[model samples]
Target chain A: MNIHAIKAIYRFEMARTGRTLFQSIVSPVISTSLYFVVFGAAIGSRIAEVDGVSYGAFIVPGLIMLSLLTQSVSNASFGIYFPRFTGTIYEVLSAPVSYLEIVIAYVGAAATKAIIVGLIILATAALFVPLEIQHPGWMLLFLLLTAVTFSLLGFIIGIWADNFEKLQFVPMLIITPLAFLGGSFYSISMLPPFWQKVTLFNPVVYLISGFRWSFYGQADVGVGVSLAMTLLFLGLCLAVIWWIFRTGYRLKS
Target chain B: MAPILSISDLSKTYDTGFQALKTVSLEIEKGEIFALLGPNGAGKTTLISIVCGIVNASSGTVTVDGNDIVRDYRAARSLIGLVPQELTTDAFESVWATVSFSRGLFGKPKAPEIVEKVLRDLSLWDKKDSKLVTLSGGMKRRVLIAKALAHEPRVLFLDEPTAGVDVELRRDMWRVIRELRDTGVTIILTTHYIEEAEEMADRVGVINKGEIVLVEEKAELMRKLGRKQLALHLAVPLAAVPDGLSAHNLELSDDGEELIYTYDTTGERTGITTLLQDLNATGIRFRDLQTRQSSLEEIFVNLVRTPS
Candidate 1:
């Protein structure tokens, strides 16, 4: 299993987060806090409630999901991509570690970082609004599943991207917008009937809806469907990763 | 004893349609310093990359200490270490951390003493805590070597270890390499610097156009392919080489003050005595004479210049 190798890589990646504390931990915490202040305080003042929950508290889970999704993708992708960019990937390729171990180390570390950020954002949200968790176990499970799935997707993007601009392409242009439109700031039901259907198509919606359901027990979609959708996406990411390693796509030549 | 590393009929045709290696086969003995000498783009890096598990071969097999590189990669790769040509390192990583990380990457248990010894051997102990980007180029090169050695592999491949370093660092690196060889580590280095091979290689392999053209003991290869030249300084100037000395195939200096005689080193007879006798009899008097042997550089140039 090369457990030592996996530990080494995981520790190395986690250490990088420590080194870039401001960017990795502090920046996300501050930005999500702003989302709370502006959206939860300024905007929630106008709307009394959504789904029988205070508007300010209603957005907490969604806001946390937004950060978790983006952070997971960026962390995992950049972790792998920087090594490729700097040519340090040669050492990793030549080492005794297996491809599965490499993926576990990188994806595991990315997910860990994203979960930490998610928890910190949740704590920050508590400072702005009264938070509740009807199903704490479900909430944790959703956080874990969503972080791991997005981190795996991020790992694929890291391998697929050949340049810096492409590295930013997914997180900035695709994920952030998806999270915004996937019910981060408001419920998907608040959207018109047509746009609500369209919002369901965004994968981020399933993740956020599942997470929000765990928090308030009031979800736009059935909890079981959201859980199934998250698992389905996780399986898809795993399949793509398996194919990538098997074919040596964008990794070996 | 069986060879520490063995490669057979290895070939690689990249997706770009460039054949980097063509049916290459070679064996490196344990604890010997073997040098793979070749020009740029001669597949030196590709061969190393394949054996180290960085690149996959299109065909053939490589075994490290009898472990097949493909089927038993973990064991095989654990037995080998590679210091790649490029100076690729994490700019933010401290020297100590990176070296330790490499050791762990090879599935070795944490051994601070071993890492310390490697760092000290490479003269990197003082900069152990410094970030990689803060180190000089030469120091970074040393760190790469340290990283490769951190796992204590049986075989080490150094790809152009001293390409752009200054003379002092080159010599220092050579000394470190020798020290490693003395510790019974099999070293296979790829270089175009003929002198590096001449100075350190126990055996030399010449690869050209994706094939190994020759592999011989350093001293034996020199004796077999090396040529000798004898230059005679004439006491008096002459207009041309005398017709009588034509049998010796002598070449006269442009100013006609010297004569040169070339002969194969491996031949039973150098013909030098006969040439001297012929010179005296022909009244070609000389003030002084000197003999020079062809270096590995000349032999290497000649080897690669010709179609194998």
Candidate 2:
């Protein structure tokens, strides 16, 4: 199982986060808090509630999902990509660790970091809005599933990217915009019927809707559909990761 | 005892169609220093990369202590350590942390004592806490060695271990390598410095253009191909060598003041006594004479310079 190798890689990555606490944890936490102040408090006070939930509270799950998606992708991508860029990947490649263990170590650490940041954002959100969890168990499941799934996507991106610009390309140009338009600051139902249909194409919507359903128990799509959709996306990411390891993709030549 | 490492018919052709290695084969004893000497682009690095599992080989197989490198990679790799050519490291990591991390990566249990010993042996103990980015190039090279040794592998492959380092660090590195050898760890190194091979190698292998030209014990290689030259300074200038010395194939100096005779050192008869007698009979008076033996560098150059 090479458990020691996994632990070594995981601890090394976690230590890197500790060393760069400001960029890794504090920066994202502060940014999400600002989003709460500007959008939830300042702006929500002027708008009516959606789905019987207050506007500020309505965006909690969406905001948390937003942070989870971006942070997971960035963290996981950079975790693997930095070694490749610095030429230190030779150590990892030559080690007795298998491909599965490498994926587990890198993706697990990234998910852990994303989950920590999500929790911190949730705590900060409490100060801005009255929050409640109708199904705490479901909420935790959604959090873990979302964190792990996006982290896997990030792992694929890390292997696929050849340059720093390409590394940032997917997370910044693709993920952030999808999360914003998917449902972060508002419900997809608020959009016109046609645009609401189009918004379904954005995979982030399924994650946000599934996560929000666990909180207030009212979601735009049926909760069952949201769960299925999340799992489907998770399955897709897993398949891609398996293919990467099988083919050695950009990780080996 | 069985060889610690064996390579048979290994070949590598990169994606770009560059054939880096071609049917290479070699073996290493359990506790000897084997030096692979070659010039740039001679497949030294490619061969080491394949054995270390960093680069996949195009054909053939390698085994470490009877564990097939591909089929049983974990067991095979666990027995080997590689100090790569480049000084690549995590810039933000401390020396102690990185070395410990390497040990753990090899699936070894945490042994701080072993890590400390490796660091101290490489003269990196005092700087263990310093970030890698802050260390000098020589210190970073030492840290690389410390990382390779952290796991206590049975065999160590050093790819250009002394390249670009200062003389003092090079000497320290040699001392550390010798100490490792004394501990019964098999050592294989590839080097551009023939003197490094001459100074440390028990057996030397010369590679050129993706082929192994020769592999022999250092002493035997030097003797087999080595040529000795005898130069005689004549008391008077002469236009050419004496007719009596033509059988000896002697060369006259451009200024005609000295004569040079070349002979194989490994030959049963150097004919020095007979040459001296013939010189005296021919009245070829000489003021002084000196003999020189060719160095390993000359032999290596001759080995690689010719077509395979």
Best by lDDT: 1
Against the true structure, what is each candidate's TM-score? 0.99, 0.98
lDDT against the true structure, each candidate: 0.94, 0.91
Model 1 per-residue lDDT tens digits across residues A197-252: 88888988888888999999888889899999999999999999999989889888
**CA error at residue B161 for candidate 1, angstroms:** 0.2
Q: How accurate is chain B of model 1, given as a TM-score from 0 to 1? A: 0.99
Q: Pick the candidate with the highest DockQ.
A: 1
Tell me the TM-score of chain B in each candidate.
0.99, 0.97
lDDT of 2 by residue, A26-129 (tens): 99888988887887889888989888999889989988998999999999999999998888898898889898899899999999999999999999899889
lDDT of 1 by residue, B1-308 (tens): 99999999999999999999999999999999999999999999999999998898999999999999989999999999899899999999999999999999999999999999999999999999999999998999999999999999999999999988999999999999999999999999999789999999999999998999999999999999989899999999889889999999999999999899999978889999899999899987899999999999999999999987
Report i-RMS for every model.
0.5, 0.8
